[model samples]
Target: MSLARPRALVFDWDNTLVDSWGTIHAALNTMFARMGHEPWTLDETQLKVRKSLRDAFPAMFGDRWEEARDLYLQAFEALHIERLSPLPDAEVLVQAIVARGHYLALVSNKTGRLLRDEVAALGWGHYFAKVIGAGDAVRDKPDRAPVDLALDGSGIAAGPAVWFVGDTGIDMACALNAGCVPILVHGPEGGLLRDEEFADATPARHFRDCMALAREISQ
Candidate 1:
């Protein structure tokens, strides 16, 4: 990692900042059943599908994508609001990073509106200067377009001064694609991205959870 301090921190939602896996796993199974795919274990789901549904489902479902999208959204909508909760130390981490005068924003492939609502529901709207979600850019993370959008309105550009912190491979890919440093927060669940399949993904830093991340960044 660079000895240079970051001017800004970008976070990924879903399993990164919050714990929504219960709802997500359940909803994904329902959608998968509708799509004729078998239900995924939480681990498999985390590993296999990380993109915001609208952004990725089209490729997975093709001509039937929109229908699958609706089913997934319907399932997610029915449960996400009620199941959402901040991960351990998430609020503290965000506060600590911001208090240190670092600019902060969120970049997630989750649909833009849903991402906004989730942040608001968590009462975390204040910590972020911006939130970039799927459809907010022409292409989502792992594609660099959304990363560009996240850095778009910032006074700073994407580079060493920025770090994209999250739990999974997609988040790592976003940072890699954008040339931003990637920091992995192992998240509430045991991390799944450390697999050998991700050999090309070498995160600049790895913390067991957000609390560890907060401690490291605050120093």
Candidate 2:
């Protein structure tokens, strides 16, 4: 599939831009332990931790979901910044895109405060016009609310001119729901999860890594 040059870009912050699974896994395990549940293995964390805590916790913890959420948040907040790590060439890619004058925003399922904290910790806050995260919008990703909130003040509408680059099926689905061009930048392993999971929301372009995507966009 061919990619249209973008006027603005909306990015996914977790695995798409940064490698945050370590912190996420640890935090999830801490919550599970507190609740007397079996902790997920790292692989299970990777496979199951896609949706926002608000969206995913209820299913995992039933009536005690809110408590689980608080526990997970506390655990995550305590260590997230220390555990933050950029994927290969992700920082350079974002800097290069900003240098080229493309308007940028981040739309992540990560909690708003934590997401912004990580962004600030990395000193990359200036690169984004908006950093929309969970609870920042009326609804989170896979819904159009976060996408709309992200582009709210940019004077840019959501459509093909807006490229949504992310690594998960949820991100692809969000792009489609928002009428933006969906571009998948899978992590280094490049499976991008199961194909059937997002079969209805196929991406317009797919890149194995951020560096490859950066090269194409810079051209």
Candidate 3:
């Protein structure tokens, strides 16, 4: 199916525009060690890390979730900025999309302060109309709350015309919940097969990378 040109574009941060798995995995392991939990391998981290800390930590750490949260955040803040890197053609894609006059926003499961910090660090803050991260709204992604917050003052409502681009099933679920068009961007290593990992909330479109998605939008 052909994609409708988006009236607005909403992007996910980690693994969508920026490559953050290494930072995420390292931080998670750091937290695991301090909490006396088993450290996850990179592949395990990729598969298991999805929901926000508030949403996922309780399940993992029970009553000690807050402690785990603090530990994880400290480790992440220490390493994320130093190791942060953008995916190939990510900035080019953002520039091209903005140049086409489409309203843009960001909705990420990453913590709000950390997400904004990463954006500012990359000098890409100006590219988005609103950057809604975890805890920015009453609820996180897949609930449609953050999606609403992201588009709040943009004069754009969440619908088919708003393309929610990301790299995970959570993203596709968010798009589906918010009535936006789900657009998946897979990495060069080929992560998240649409028919397999995302069968329940499949993307409306898929691209191999940022460059491919950029080309599709340009067409």
Residue 71 local lDDT, model 1: 91
What is the C-alpha lDDT profile of model 1 across 1-219, one tens digit per residue? 445789988899888889878888898899999889888898887677787777678788899998988898889988888889999998999999989999899888888888899998888898898888888988878787876777777788988889989887778878888889988888334444557534677687778988898988789
lDDT by residue for model 2 (1-219), tens: 666689899999999999988999999999999999998999999888889889998898899999999999999999998888999999878987997888999999999999999999999999999999899999998999999888887889999899999987889999999999998898325344456656788788888888898898788
TM-scores, one per candidate? 0.91, 0.95, 0.96
| Residue 183 in candidate 2, Cα distance off native in Å | 0.7
Task: Supply the global lDDT for candidate 1.
Answer: 0.83
* RMSD to native, candidate 3: 1.6
Ranked by TM-score, the better of candidates 1 and 2 is: 2
Model 1 / residue 173 / CA error / Å: 1.5
Q: Name the runs in model 2 displaced over 4 angstroms.
A: 187-194
lDDT of each: 0.83, 0.89, 0.92
Q: Superposing all C-alpha atoms, what RMSD in Å does each candidate have to the true structure?
A: 2.4, 1.7, 1.6
Q: Between 2 and 3, whose TM-score is larger? A: 3
lDDT of 3: 0.92
TM-score of 2: 0.95
The candidate that achieves the highest TM-score relative to the unseen native structure:
3
The predicted structure with the larger lDDT, 2 or 3, is 3
Ranking by TM-score: 3, 2, 1
